[model samples]
Target: MFSGLITYLDSIRARDPAPRSRWEVLFYPGVWAVGLHRVAHWLFQARLYFLARFVNHFSRFLTAIDIHPGATIGRNFFIDHGFTVIGETAEIGDNVTIYQCVTLGGTNPTNGVGGKRHPTLEDNVIIGSGAQIIGPITIGQRGRVGANAVVTDDVPEGATMVGLKARSTLVPAEEWIKDFIPYGTPCDEPCEELMETGAGRLAELESQLAEMKAELAAIKAERAQPIKRNGTDD
Candidate 1:
């Protein structure tokens, strides 16, 4: 058990560089949250709903991280910071890392029946801060979600998602080969290039729009001119 705890701390350290030692990691709210959640999940599995909820509430009160007792979590799942919410039907696989203020939220079903409404995150998935992963979507293995993204659809394996509606960004092979990316975003030269290209396209479109407006104004001016009879104004 001590060995497993050490391994978990090491995993967190691998992801976050802020901690100097394993003892420092012990003070993290995320560590306490996951630890208490284990007990809550065990009680939930035993059919002791009230006790499970009690533990869940206690953990949330202490850590500021709300994880439903009914949620299923796997080994080495690390929450980098606090203020994260995991819904009842959410299932997380091994080595999944979630940042602060992320929500593994569920969708409301019209049938009034509780089923798989939350998301399923596969192994090695990374969810950035403030990301909302809603519905019964499956985030495939090694998938990366950027900060503040709102994801409602299934994400393909090894895909990097960004933006408000969470569109996939094509990552270079070298970047993809890396094991972990902070905040689930690859802000390398490729990303910079894409941004530059988008800016250029926007500028081009604005210039075209300005030219079109000028042409329309000239046409209207020509139409408003008085009619002429044999080159003389009417």
Candidate 2:
């Protein structure tokens, strides 16, 4: 058990550069939150719902992280900072890292029945700060969601998602091969490439618009021409 704790702390250290030592990691709110969540989850599984809820509330009071007792979390699930909420039906896989102020939110069932309402994070998935992963969408393995993204769809494996409505950004092989990317975004090259692509698309659209205008003008000119009767001008 001690060795497993050490491994978990080391995993957090590997991801965060601010921690000077494992001892410092122990003092992190995220660490406390995960620890307390374990107790709450055990109680929840044992059918002690009240006790589980009490523990969960206490953990939230102490760590400012709200993880539902019913949520299933796998090994090395790290919440980097506080103000994160995990819904009841949320399922998180191993090595899933979530930054501050993220939500694994649920949607109301139309049939009024409880089911898988929250998002699922596959192994090695990273969710940046303030990201809202709504509904029962699954973020695939190695998927990276950028800060402030609002995702409502399933993310493909190894994809990088960004923007308000959260669209996947095309990442180069070299960039995608990295083991970890902070804030789940490769801003330098990928952003520039997107800009260039957008510009090219805009130019292509403008060219097509010009061609369409020319065709319309030709049609109008042909229609406006005087009609001829028996080869005579009318």
Candidate 3:
């Protein structure tokens, strides 16, 4: 357990720019939440239902990051900014990074039956802020969920997902692991400038098209007029 705690702290230190010392990491909400969760999960497995629930509830109240004792989370997991929610059946693998306001929630909340109602995230998964991964979908390893994306389907390995319903595009795992993107969207610096340029060019092309249509109408009007021959009235 101590080894797992050390790994979790190391993960937070490596990923997050803040926290220079062990004392600071000790004060981190994520660290405390995950640590408390380990103990609670053990209690849950031991059939100490009340104790487990109490610990989980206290952790939630303290951290603002709700993680059920029933959720199975692996080592080196990091949750940034707090306010994230992991459902009872949600499963998280090792080296996972989850940002603020992320939810691994169920589509059917009121069902009391025993089944996989929450999503599962594989190792090295990065979930951005405000991203909602609903249902019992499984996100593959090295997958990235962009900010504000709503993912309802299974994500493939080493893929980047973005948009409302979300779209997936494959990426090299080595490159993604090397350079970390904050929001997890693969839009580079040039892409932003290119988007602005494209919009301007589209508006310019529309104006030119309208001018050409006006000239064509004028030419057609001139051609429609009857040509009168000299010394002949028709």
Candidate 4:
């Protein structure tokens, strides 16, 4: 693959170049790699199956990136060129930017006779390049997955996930997110809060009423008792 040679060249350049201008002419292997990927996909779509397949294999060998031709990708699917891998079953949303070294793969390696082996990204989800989303979980609309996070389960709508197992750390719309289970601040639901407060107040008032009735009964009992004797003859 051309990418492999480029990587080796880049590495050698890094080591052998003069210290003053070592990185002056940095070569980006990823840009051409991604651009080539798009072209290969285009070839396949245009019915040049054999050439497309060859390009795909070669690209992977060189760039360490393997994008499945069958994967449904929307508009503006840009990935920073590098060791990136996208699975055959991966479904990418529109305007999604994937950085280098990201993996959208399956747990069992073959997509495992899939019913839904890869993650389904919704619209406007910004995955900080290097995020790995595996399994058939649904990442809700506008969710953000932080860099290098390993996601295995479903993420709630408009939430931000970081760390391993991808726990929802923040919800952009607090009230709309109730599935935040990991260090998530309670969503602000004014109506729900008001209902709870009202219910609590009602219980307190009922207790106060019961206590007042008991006091009134005690006073009446005292008045009806021995006080009658004081109202006697003299």
- Model 2 misplacement above 4 A: 195-234
Per-residue lDDT tens digits for candidate 2, residues 1-234, read: 999999999999999999899999999999999999999999999999999999999999999999999999999988998999999999999998999999999999999998999999999999999999999999999999999999999999999998889998878888888889888877675454555456666687889999999999999999999999999997
Per-residue error (Å), model 4, residue 25: 15
lDDT of each model, Cα atoms only?
0.93, 0.93, 0.84, 0.64
- Displacement of residue 181 (Cα, Å) in model 2 is 0.4
Scored against the true structure, residue 102 in model 4 reaches a CA lDDT of 82
10 residues in a row with least lDDT, candidate 2: 189-198
TM-score of 3: 0.77
Off by over 4 Å in 1: 192-234
- Could you give me the TM-score of model 2 versus the true structure? 0.84
Better of 1 and 4 by TM-score: 1
* Residue 62 in model 3: lDDT: 96
Q: Write the per-residue lDDT of candidate 4 for residues 63-117, one digit (tens) a residue.
A: 7778766566764454545678877667878645566688888777564566667
Order of candidates by lDDT, top first? 1, 2, 3, 4
Q: What clash pairs does model 1 have? A: none
TM-score quality measure for candidate 4: 0.54
Per-model C-alpha RMSD: 5.3, 4.9, 4.5, 12.0
Clashing pairs in 4: 4-62, 30-81
Lowest summed lDDT across 10 adjacent residues in model 1 is found at 191-200
RMSD to the native, candidate 4? Answer: 12.0
Top candidate by lDDT: 1
Winner of 1 and 2 under lDDT: 1
Instruction: After superposing candidate 3 on the true structure, give the runs of residues whose Cα lies further than 4 Å from its correct spot.
Output: 1-4, 109-112, 169-179, 187-234
